[model samples]
Target: MRLEPDVILANRLADAAGEVIRPYFRQLTSVEAKPDRSPVTAADTAAEEVMRRILKQDRPADGVIGEELGFERLGAGRIWVLDPIDGTRAFIAGRPIFGTLIALVVDGQPVLGVIDQPISGERWIGQIGSWPSTTLNGRRVQVRPCRALAEAHLATTSPMLFSRSGHAAFARIARASRDTILGGDCHNYAMLASGQLDLVMEEGLKVHDWAALVPVVAGAGGVMTDWRGQPLRLGAMGAVLAAGDARVHAEALERI
Candidate 1:
């Protein structure tokens, strides 16, 4: 399939994001608290501002939805979803696994997506329908097959996101999985796309958090959906389940 303009633009968006984020990585300067009690760094706002400026210049009619700066022109058919840093805690803690996410959604479905790790100098790019495979640092990547949950390797941003009563469901999948990784954010999904990881389950995610990763996993021969097997929508339930194998996805969905 041919590459669309949006796919090419997503690359520029990643480049724009990297410029603002790399300087703040491990600097931890002037961290502020949001109403939700989540930490926000100057890098977050700066990176998103770069995206907004570039998009406003290049795709003036397109909409933008950003984690740090909020939304603008969301009703437009084509909207850019931006998450300057998907793992702020890890970023402030000096981890390079945190990533910048950019997704171009067309009519509520993500048509193009990118996960960029500026400090690590790695990126995973994916586009739905335009290509059936994903690219990691320009190298094509695909997910490996895992037929059962018992053989799966799972990853999540954090297990603590689960409530005390919700632990039972999470524990069931944890027991079935061979290993569970904590706190990799979108980088974990990039690993899943590149065949290094088998599954990732997450909760309390916003559109900017998961939109870019959805196409990355789907294009890499993985299945991504909500716990009940529903398609993820903007501002939908935060629960997300993704697996390299469909059978494993089905198996885990039953437990989630």
Candidate 2:
């Protein structure tokens, strides 16, 4: 079956989201706290709205699960999972590390993904199956090789997002790694796909936060799975572990 149309639509969704987000990046005067205490801004809401509108018009049969918006057509065979502004805290701080995450998940598995950093003009696209390579701005990119966890550079969004046990598990992996970066949100995975980072582990991710990352990381020759070493899907637990090298991932999983 042809996937070009789906790929085209995914890019369009990312483009639309970026346009809506750029204006509100640092111009938002107020940030509202969701009941879950996560931050949301006008940019986040507006971006998701625009993407949803486009999907409604162009791919009415596809489902949508978006941050800043609610689920729609959940039982559809294909769903677009969106996190319009993945790093809201960084965006509100005037940082350009935030990104728009778009993923096309068929059934429960993500088959195509896009990560767009609008301010930096960087976009990574990853699609599974026969078209397996990941690309950054149309150029092919792959993960760097790291044979051992001790040689790996690790990263996570925040230690606070981890539970007591999850934090302890991450702490073990961090202690075993060469270094750890504290923040970058979804951008961390993009960097990993570009060979700039080796591993990223985090907890408390929703489906929209991680769905796009699987294809990106996997297409770059990396492995991304839950702490239990199982593949991520629509209903998997939120703990995430990604490594550019399979051996490093296995070692890290053992530690967890």
Output the TM-score of candidate 2.
0.98
In model 1, the runs with Cα more than 4 Å from the true position are: 1-3
lDDT measured at residue 199 in model 2 versus the true structure, 0 to 100: 94
Query: Which candidate wins on lDDT?
Result: 2
Residues 24-71, model 2: lDDT tens digits: 867889999999999999889999999999999998999999988899
Which consecutive 10 residues in model 2 have the weakest lDDT in total? 125-134
lDDT of candidates 1 onward, in order: 0.87, 0.92
User: Could you tell me which residue pairs clash in candidate 2?
Assistant: none
Off by over 4 Å in 2: 130-132
What C-alpha RMSD separates each model from the true structure? 1.4, 1.0
Any idea how many clashes model 2 has? 0
- Per-residue C-alpha lDDT of model 1 across residues 74-184, encoded as one tens digit per residue: 899888999999899888899899999999888888767899999989999987774465899889999999989989999988888876645677888999899988889
What TM-score goes with each of the models?
A: 0.96, 0.98
**Candidate 1 has which clashing residue pairs, if any?**
none
